[model samples]
Target: MPHRSISAPRHRAPALPSTDYDVIIIGAGSAGLSAALSLGRCLRRVLVCDGGPPRNAPSPGVQSFFTRDGIKPAELLRVGLDQLKPYDTVEVRAAQVQRVTPGFQVFEVEAEGESGRTFTVTARKLLLATGVEDELPPVPGMRDLWGRGVLHCPYCHGWEVRGQALAVYGQGKIVTGMALLVSRWAPDLVVCTDGAGHLSPNARRRLRQQKIQLNEEPISHLEGTANGQLRHIVFKNGDKLARHALFVHPHQHQRSTLAEQLGCRLTSKGAIWINKHSQTSISGLYAAGDITPGPQKALLAAAEGTEAAIAIHETLTREECPK
Candidate 1:
């Protein structure tokens, strides 16, 4: 018999009615939904362009999100969307934004849906909640364990895997710093250099003083369960390290290029630079969430989104309202 590969089903985007709105938000994650909620409450016509596959899509559940703690990321987003039901002014479409062009008084956004249908929308203000993408190391089976046993953000997943046999995977000063941070929850921690061997003398000394084991062997692959629960770290030399959890400091990049295309200044860490008002370098452009420079957390991103919505409302009122 011939073997056949099965692919996962695709999600279809909803129909988008109009081409004009008070505010057009890109990326319908927590940050985008929060902004839309605030704007909808204020009776503003808000449109949220949600490109599927959020940053947390691979994770089983969200942590440290207050009442919604431990909830599935998708369910949390569904609840958020449901909450906006009363507001007819808010609309969400599963579409990837292609480009953003500036206009005289509004910004033009071009997006393509899953069905290859293209649409354009103009808005008085634009908000970017398009989070960052995690660039994982090329070790075999690492991608399968991502967001499960192989994780990042100590604050987000540390409590869940507390006191487990944990390993920090990466090299450089940042990885050392992350190892230190992970030490708070994991007393028995090992630092895997993954053959990079870029740790400084001071970092090595600190690790030694802290009794943290440093492994410089090249990683062959990760051994995990069918459900992505990591079991062991297999080295190229045939040695294996038993690890229940692995903390990683993977490289990250902006999920969308619309921010850079709009000329929004980026921070040293490659996140969008925004002021207290959540406004970016461009006058009518605002940003929130992991795309902006700061600690990446769902709650923090939502708060920033709310703040950005308020700032946008105030700015629009100031300009449009008659004195």
Candidate 2:
């Protein structure tokens, strides 16, 4: 019964201030921080509350992002904070939000962090930049190899494993698509359906034409070295397949429980539903990033962040002037 020590810490929110902020953004990841930068430029009082566990923290580096492609997550975030520093209106706090409640003019937020301290702040508007969690498969040893030899985004790590032996793990029709796409990087690709039904005739044809192995055996477990680098895949039949890397299609879930707790309408995939203005069904509350229940990608999350900030800014102006 011990918690994982992810980082050394001194987390404490300053005493609850009396003034109401123009905006309060929760979950300081790419989306939350991006929105804060935009609102700060407008001289809005923006408070960013960070719980500090990012979904991509396991990945070695971020890719496909313009200008900063392949940069470490910490480095990217550090540079982001430096850029946002000039905007004096923004304050970054390393605190965990406990709850959010609608108030008369805005909303009330309670946050607590290390040192057993708590602070409350009120905001005229709220933005939920909470992201999503990758629901990994229940396979043993796979979790340890995640973001190292096992990955999700081919666009992110395909180059790194190009020409290596790769395995695509999924079921049904999805595996067909993953196999075809992943074959671009590695000619030695295996489609592991985990004892699932066979692919369609056309699907099987496409895979063979691409020279990808269609493997229907159930996965007994993943084999890795003592250091946790994946070396091979062990099947239920006691056969071992050498695999340099793996591609998994994990189910995703939203990270923000507060949004659901506050009654924000969610998508079928459990993402927050927002309009063009990024306003959710709950007025004064907006959401961005993977938490919104759609396909998850970094560029898309950042775009949603910027859009939410703009929408919040407009609402602030209208509410402040009452015109």
TM-scores, all candidates, are: 0.92, 0.90
> Tens-digit lDDT track for model 1 on 194-311?
8977988999998888778899999999999999999999999999999999999888999898888778899888999999999999988999999998788898989999999999
In candidate 1, which residue pairs clash? none
lDDT by residue for model 2 over 58-143, one digit each (tens)?
88888888888889888877887788899988998988889998966569999996656998889878999878888888888899
- In candidate 1, what residue range of length 10 has the lowest lDDT sum? 10-19
Clashing residue pairs in candidate 2, if any?
Answer: 271-292, 271-293, 272-292
Error of 2 at 193 (Å): 1.3
Off by over 4 Å in 2: 1-19, 226-228
Q: Give me the candidate number with maximum lDDT.
A: 1
